[model samples]
Target chain A: MSIETDIKQKKFRSPYQRLALNLIYTSNWIQYQQVDGFREHDITSQQYNVLRILRGQYPSPIKVSDIAERMLDKNSNTSRLIDKLLAKKLVDRKSCPNDRRAVDVVITEAGLELLKKLDPVVDEWDNNMNAITHEEADLISSLLDKIRESKNNN
Target chain B: MSIETDIKQKKFRSPYQRLALNLIYTSNWIQYQQVDGFREHDITSQQYNVLRILRGQYPSPIKVSDIAERMLDKNSNTSRLIDKLLAKKLVDRKSCPNDRRAVDVVITEAGLELLKKLDPVVDEWDNNMNAITHEEADLISSLLDKIRESKNNN
Candidate 1:
């Protein structure tokens, strides 16, 4: 199950190239695995991410910009995502009392309920990582952290 | 920076959860790094991936479905992506001679030229991985492969 075989490519120009492709491909693979579970609950992973962020804040609402900053996929249109969640009545958007020009977004009761249902789905996903040991997971996480170290400085 | 600081979160439920988030976040981080370069050439990363797939099959045409199978991002609408590339004149689409019902796709001369210009951008990205050693890259690539091993079985 090497990347070469998975992608049907015979070789890479370098290890870094292979690693680069591996990271993107594996990330997509993980997301695809969750698609069915997320679709069952009628939410895309990004929307689920938004709901989770709001749930984390609970009673306190956060600005759309802050949600965008924390989103795993930075390119997602935060405002548009909020609009969709609002349409579904899973989230509430209101003018910020502290900053009238800004908007505050909070998860509604339905959103929290949806996440409560989704908790096991996510837990199953985490459990699947049991294929790799805890020490390995820690090592991989640290390596990923190191990979992003240089980018943070810039 | 650690995933915690990067996402502005203070905790993860477990190491596996941390690893999962790290994988997605780092992958997106890598992609965002390439956006500006791809944008300069008027293509999204998914489009870039399509062009590369076509380039790999150069001197021969491929079917849209085949392109989808080879794509890194499984959720990308391959046909729509080809339509965009077609509009931009970066690729050519024609009816298959053998299977009239199937459409064939090939990278145009313009597409090849665009990739040539993008070579440096991609090279710079590979170079940035100097933050991690070649050994670390290899290790990560293997770990990712291991992570997907279970998924491939299903």
Candidate 2:
């Protein structure tokens, strides 16, 4: 799965260039797999992420802003995802007890049950990350953090 | 910039889970920066990628599917992106000589010139990938390849 072999591109300006492209490509590759698994349960990754976050704070409602902050895709439309989940009856929405315009969101029992069924598939994909050793996984994550630490050129 | 601090989350089921999320998150972060730079030049990443691909095939007309196959994001609507670049007068599209319905696509002078201007910014981003050593870039790319080599559970 070298970038060349994976994408069928024969040349890159440099290893760094290939790595930059490969990082984006591989992430999309991994994403499609996760999307396929999540699709079986009728949810997008964003919705599943929100559901999981709510479940983590189970029995205690969390603010929509809090969920947005914790999401992997910071630009994801939290309200849209929430609306979808609510339509599916997988999540609950209610006016905050303390603030009229604020909302308290939580995973419904159905959402928890859905995730319980999805746990094995999700767990399997997580295990697939072992395609590289634990040490390599740690190394990749650290390197990615370093990549982001580079000053924003804007 | 550690995962915990970046995402403000204290727990991950394992390093692999963190790596999976980090891969996608960092890719998105890098993309935004690239998008910002490309925007300064009046192009999106997808358009830039198309231009680069067309430049690679300079002096030769390429089919739309060929461009699609070479794209980093396989799901990109290359025809649509081509439409945008075409509207900007950056790419030339014509009916393939041999096939009436098939179109031949090539980067116009304007497109190549645009890329020439973007080269410095793109190069800077590639250099930014050097936030890690060349050895680390290779390592991360190889590890990412391995990450995708895992069996598709479906």
Alpha-carbon DockQ of candidate 2: 0.76
- iRMSD (1 decimal) for each model: 1.2, 1.3
Give the runs in model 1 whose Cα sits over 4 Å from its true position.
Answer: B87-89, B92-95
Q: Give the candidate number with the greatest DockQ.
A: 2
Score residue A72 of candidate 2 by CA lDDT: 85
DockQ of 1: 0.70
lDDT of candidate 1 over B1-154, digit per residue (tens): 9898888777777888889889999988888888876787778999998998888999799999888888887778998999899999999999999999899999999999998888878978887877888998898888888878866665
**Model 2 lDDT tens row, A17-98:** 8898998998888798888878867899889889888988999998888899888888999999999999999989999989
Q: Which ten residues in a row have the lowest lDDT in candidate 2 chain A?
A: A145-154
The C-alpha RMSD in Å for every predicted model, in order, reads 2.3, 2.1
TM-score of 1: 0.89
Docking model 2 quality class: medium
Model 2 lDDT tens row, B21-137? 898888888798898888778899999999998999998989888899888899998889999999999999998989887889999999999999988888888888667898888
Candidate 2 — number of clashing residue pairs? Answer: 0
